[model samples]
Target: MNTSSTPTPESTSRLSEPVAGAPLVLPVIEEHAVVGREMVETGRVHLTKTVEEHEEALNFTLLHDEVQVERVPVNQYVADGATLPGVRYEGDTMVIPVVREVVVKRMLVVEELHITKHQVPTQESHRVVLRQESVQVTREPAPGTIIPPTASTPAS
Candidate 1:
């Protein structure tokens, strides 16, 4: 029997009676969504390499050591059974003694060499050619596709 202000399809079905000695069973319903993914190709990029040349000036100081050799003749006799004289330095000059053997079994000092050093600095200028590489990127959209506006860094 109907016992509501208005009989509805949902209420009528819920109130139906079951078979004798059989427990009443309620039905439950649930909804779900199905998801999937697809791959897509957008565009292509082209790179171009180029070289640039220019002249630049370089300025610096050049330093070098200059040697001056002066030979002084010293004809002096050494003492008998005396050890030979070793090299000695006088201030910035290096003195090297040259010795000779005489016929009387004696050692004689023939000549002395004086070596002096000096530092000379000079300024110089030179022009040199230098090369630099730069790359430019060009974008090509796929067939029947639209390209968007974007910001990018400049190549050095």
Candidate 2:
């Protein structure tokens, strides 16, 4: 329970009006201002990608396949009833096609491809390359007042 004192009429009149002879001591009241901060959008950030090509020497390992073809002299010819293989591709290697006809069997035959994969790990240097996207920072002041860096950096 809250108990409060109610001022009577005489006490109210005395508080409002000062005495005539004696010096009156009035209480002085002061009001202070309150400052607050608010968040607002200042500017927008736009990101764009641009591709630029340049020739520069760089040392790195690249993944690729290289096919080496060696022609061996085949003096011996196939037999009359021998069948030849067909042409095909193995990985990055392609085989040349060669057709043959069997005399006795009367069957068609083609050449086959023997593919050998070789991975040669090498170090190479590339030229200067331009990046597509970059980071940029921009600062914008508020509408009413531009707060100084020192003021804004301080703790609230």
11-84: candidate 1 lDDT, tens digit per residue: 66765677799998888989998898887667778999999999999999999999999999998989998899
lDDT values for all models: 0.90, 0.58
Candidate 1 deviation (Cα RMSD) = 8.2
lDDT for residue 76 in candidate 1, whole number 0-100: 90
Candidate 2 contains a number of clashing pairs equal to: 12
For residues 1-156, could you state the per-residue lDDT of candidate 2 as single tens digits?
Answer: 224488666665635566689888877889999999998766555555456565566678977777676443333345555555445676766665444545654444343435556787777776776555455555555567556566556678
Best candidate per lDDT, number?
A: 1
Leading candidate by TM-score:
1
Q: Residue 94 in model 1: shift from native, Å?
A: 2.0
